[model samples]
Target: MRFSDFALGLGVAVFGIAVLLHVRTFPEIPGMQYGPAFFPGLIGAAFLICGVALVVGSVVRGAALTERFAERPAWFGDRLAVWRAVGVVLSVVAYALVSPVLGFLLTVALLTAGLLLLMGVRWVVVVPLMVLLPLFLHYGFAQGLRVPLPRGPLELLLF
Candidate 1:
């Protein structure tokens, strides 16, 4: 846990520096109260602050935290969970790469299907979930939030 805290602290410090760099370059846009970089800059600052706190807390409670984890069964130490997590991360990367080409509807639906399958959901349930989720998201964002969705060939065929 000490190592985890150290890594998180280091990562957040690096991320904060990266965001600060972009915010420095972000040009001011008129009429809006905040520029494009405002929210991300805020988040990066928050992350840096929280990371420092975590590192300090970890140092204070180091021995106790190590004892707690040591009490857990050896079976819980299986590192395969990390590989499984990597697959989920890769799935998101795949979605980003394909979203523009496949468009929002198809890309989101495929992502839902892939995630459900990865989680061991059967095809019978996965199919309906994959189809309905993207439609639900479309309604939630496009209709409710008044956000326009990217339309590709699917729009031409469906609507």
Candidate 2:
């Protein structure tokens, strides 16, 4: 738990620094209004505060925390779960990289396909989901949130 606290604290510190750098790039708004950096800065500060609280709480309660977050053994017993987490992280990274080039819908479709395939889902089920998830996400994000996503190579085919 102490080690977790140390790691989280370090991560939060680094994230806060990153947010600060981003904030510096934006021009200040007039009339005390919020600027582009407002939300990200707020989120970064929240992360920093939560991290500090976790470290402090861990210090106060460390002796009493006998069971690690879950009851499973540390190493080999949880290897599969750890690998799944790693796969998810990699998938997200892949989506981020591909989204600009392949477009949001295609990237999301690929992400869904990869995840479903890795989870042992059948191709019949996986293929439909791969096609549907991206369409759903595109509508949800673009129509619902009013945020536009890149169309990339599929723009002509889609629109």
Candidate 3:
């Protein structure tokens, strides 16, 4: 659905405030400034700031809300765009459903490759992205974030 900048900004700002308020109720760990809510709170604050900025910018520019929208191409009217969007959504849903059986790395790699292919990306570029992106994400979440991702038989054997 389309929304004016003012309306969108207001909605985002409200959402951010709600997030901030909800996160405040989480239990804080002693001797640590960061906790489960830390990242969420930061994101909420960023959203609030960006929303306010958009609202102010729109007002200051003296541009009508409809004028901003008129500059954009017709997304829903395009057949290719609709197909691309559907493909992306299906890929994501398939990844989620298959991840437990195939493991995060394998499932994500396949999904990425499929998406890249759908976007008409070259095999050379798609190949590296499919291989590297999953590994990087796995390392980042498993090691950096200390959050373990699901492991299938293949992942169990390799790592």
**Which lDDT tens digits does candidate 1 get at residues 1-159?**
234665566677778777877787887788887998898888878877877776676678774245332244453476655555766899889877887788888888888897787777899999999999988988899779988787667755875
RMSD of each: 7.6, 7.4, 8.1
Supply the TM-score for candidate 3.
0.52
Q: Say which prediction, candidate 2 or candidate 3, comes out ahead on lDDT.
A: 3
**Cα lDDT tens digits for candidate 3, 19-128:** 99999998899999999899999999998998887777778877536444423447878887888899999997997799989998889899999899888899999999
Task: Judge candidate 2 at residue 18 and give its lDDT.
Answer: 77
Return model 3's CA RMSD, one decimal: 8.1
lDDT of 2 by residue, 1-159 (tens): 124554556567678777867787888788767888888888878777877776666667763254244344464467766776777999989977888899888788888888887776899999989888888878888879988887777754876
Better of 1 and 3 by lDDT: 3
TM, every model: 0.52, 0.52, 0.52
Please report the candidate that would top lDDT against the real structure: 3
Task: Give Cα-based local distance difference scores for all models.
Answer: 0.75, 0.75, 0.85
Model 1: lDDT equals 0.75
- Which residue pairs show backbone clashes in model 1? none
**Arranged by lDDT, best first:** 3, 1, 2
